[model samples]
Target chain A: MLSKKAQYAFRALAHLVEHYDSGPVLIAEIAKKKRIPLKFLESILLELKKNNILESKKGKGGGYFLKKDPSQTYIATVIRIVDGPISLLPCVSLYFYQRCKNCNEKHCGLHDIMKSVRDATLNILEKRTLKDLI
Target chain B: MLSKKAQYAFRALAHLVEHYDSGPVLIAEIAKKKRIPLKFLESILLELKKNNILESKKGKGGGYFLKKDPSQTYIATVIRIVDGPISLLPCVSLYFYQRCKNCNEKHCGLHDIMKSVRDATLNILEKRTLKDLI
Candidate 1:
């Protein structure tokens, strides 16, 4: 399951994608429109800015905007930043791989099955971007 | 991520699947072999038994065995029993469906992508049975 943080991240970014050319949108507006808590949405957008996925302006008319095109910002990247691995099992994860202590990878059926699950999920997430949501 | 309870449940059932037709196996043996804590394994197996995936023999040589053939037990069933829904988002879930509070299903791209994810996971997990693990 996607964590609440990841879900909020998607909502916030999608809002930015929707208003890309309308100048920086305020945090309060995104919070109100997305139904995300104001404090939490502020933190999420700040993190996205720190990662270069979003950029912020200061002073009058200041707010946040996508630093990269929405199509270039993959959902998989955001999920990874906020939720760790896309894989259900650490052993099968590409970005966050960890060997299972209890089983041999050569023979473990669950590992094989989970790898396929991860692959299927990653395939869609990597292909789709925030633009797709907008 | 799979919950710890679901992981323990899978370990316990896979142990049972391996020992099927060889008589009931002790909980301690499975716990020690699978590196799962004894108390946790006990609860997990009991849940599986209560769901009819397993049965206890009682008395001398008593332990647990698959109540139905391992081939008849699906991983998706166990996951659903423990994890609620296979979908990443509640709106995409079939058995545990709920409308998203923040978005319209007709226009929400995240909803569409997650449906594909849920379908892909369900296809694999429903097709592969406990017998496949053994």
Candidate 2:
């Protein structure tokens, strides 16, 4: 399941996507619109900014905006940026691969099955962009 | 990602599946073979037992075993029993549905996309069983 942080990030991004051409949106506006807490959204947006998925301005009329077009931003990218691995098992993860203890990847049935699950999930998330979300 | 508890449950169940017809297998044997901590495996097995997926025996030559045929035990069932929901979002979940906060389910894009993802994942997990894992 996606964490609350990841879910909030998606909600916040979707709000930004709606205002993609309208310039920056205040964090307070997004929090109010999406029902995300203001303090939680501040950190989430900051993380996105650090990852270059978003940009911000300061002072009067200052707020946040997407760094890239919504069409160019994939759900998979957002998930990875905020929620980490998409795979259920570390051994099956393509982007965050780690050897599972006590199992041989070559012979593990769970590995074989979970790898298929990861591929199926990625097929959707990688193909769907933020533009598709709106 | 699968929780450590869920992963350990799967690993322990896989071990049980391998020794299904050979009478109850010792907990120590499963722990050592699967690299699961003995105490953790005990709780996992007990949970599976409560879920009717496993049963145990006591005294000499006693241990835990699958309550049903491996072929009849779906991976989806195990995951739900141990890990709760399979879908990325609560709104998209079939067995564990919950309305997402501050979102209209009918108009939510994340809900729509995650529903597709849930379907794709269930296609694999529901069809695959403990038998396949062996």
Candidate 3:
């Protein structure tokens, strides 16, 4: 359901959530904790900061911190921000719906089956926030 | 939730299921019908047969056939055989239960959330047989 990017992003964010509202969270610390590449994590945090999921400062005593407590940030939100959709197949996806190449959108035989999968996926991913993971 | 190999395997199998009980299913036919590469599908089918989901014969008038109906074969089985586990995270995985690197395996905090996701994914995938997709 999630991509490598989304997985990496969630792992990083969960680390932030663990230290939520206390102080700035360092990119290096998160990268080391999550086994993510430092440069790659730097970019991921920048994107999260852009999306207001995290707030950051560049100087000493300055690092990224959650804009909200981890409990408030849903895993679905992180996934959508990082991966565009919780479902890889657009035909079954709610957040990123698209027609299958050779099928009718309204009466697709695949619609029901795929929808069930999509809903199940969302049900699990949507309920869990960063707090749940940590 | 799905790997590239699983997705491709499912696609190829669905194509085979479509033509079930009709005649011998050519590897090329299933590959082309499903838009999968011929060579990659060859290996996928071989594995499927190794699991007895399919039966094959070499030479002319021989290709492949479902050992049983596509409806009898669960997507979960295919996935497990091909990709080991549906869950990417080891903490909540059903088939491949490895301990998380930083957590106590017995009472891991990540367990419930990951389990829910795993269950949801499995519920959807398990209900879907190749016949459903076809």
Candidate 4:
């Protein structure tokens, strides 16, 4: 399941994608339009900015905008940045792999199945970008 | 991400699948072998039993076993019982569908993408059963 944080991030990103060339969008406007709580959305956008997915301007007409073209922003990238991992098991994760205690991945049935699941999920997430969302 | 509860459930179920038709296996044995905490595994097994995926016997030689054949238990069934929904978005879930607050599902791009994701995930999870785990 997508975390509340990741869901909000997607909602906020979709809004930004819609306003891509129109310039910065106010945080408050996104909050009101997307129904995300203001404080939570602020943190989500800041995290996106820190990860270089977004940038902002200050003063008059100041607001947030995508740092890259929506076509270049893969759904998988955003999900990983906000949600930590795509795999259900840490052992099968491509970017967040970790050895399960007292378990051998080479001989684990769960590992093999989860790896397939991760691959299947990534097949869709990696191919679709924010541009595709629009 | 899979909840710790769901992960433990899979590990326990996989252990049961290995010992299917042999006899009821001790919970303590599964806990030690799977590296699951004993207390946690107890609750998980109880939940699976409640969902009719597992059955337990009491007294000497007592333990838990699969209620149905390993091949009859779909991975998606266990996951949905243990972890709620497979889809990232509530609106896209087939069995656990819920309307997204303040949003129209028909015109939502995230909804469409998530529906695709749900289908891809279900494609793998629904076809594979406990028999395939071993």
The Cα local distance difference test for each model comes to 0.87, 0.92, 0.76, 0.89
lDDT of 2 by residue, A7-93 (tens): 999999999999998988999999998899999999999999999899999988989999998989899999999999999998999
In candidate 4, list every pair of residues with a backbone clash: none
- Sort by lDDT, best first: 2, 4, 1, 3
- The predictions' CA RMSDs to the true structure, in order, are 1.3, 1.2, 3.2, 1.6
lDDT of 4 at A116: 87
Residues B1-134 of candidate 1 have per-residue lDDT tens digits of: 78878877888888888788999999899998889999988888888888878899888899988899889999899888877788898899888998988889998888998988888888898898887775
| Segments of candidate 2 deviating more than 4 angstroms | none
Off by over 4 Å in 4: none
Q: What is the DockQ of each candidate?
A: 0.79, 0.85, 0.39, 0.69
Candidate 1 docking class: medium
What tens digits encode model 1's per-residue C-alpha lDDT throughout A39-129? Answer: 9889888988888899999998999999988889998999888878888888899999988887788988888899888888888889988
Model 3 lDDT tens row, B51-115: 98999989998998888888888877887898786774766777787766655556544556667
True interface contacts retained by model 3: 0.43
Q: Per-residue lDDT for A1-134 in model 3, tens only?
A: 34567667877776787787679978998888889989998999999889878899888988899998777778778877887866646777776776667455575434566677677777777777788876
The residue pairs that clash in candidate 3, if any, are A1-B1
Greater-DockQ candidate between 1 and 2: 2
Per-residue CA lDDT of model 4 for A64-120, tens digit only, reads: 999999999999999999998989889889999888874578887767788888888
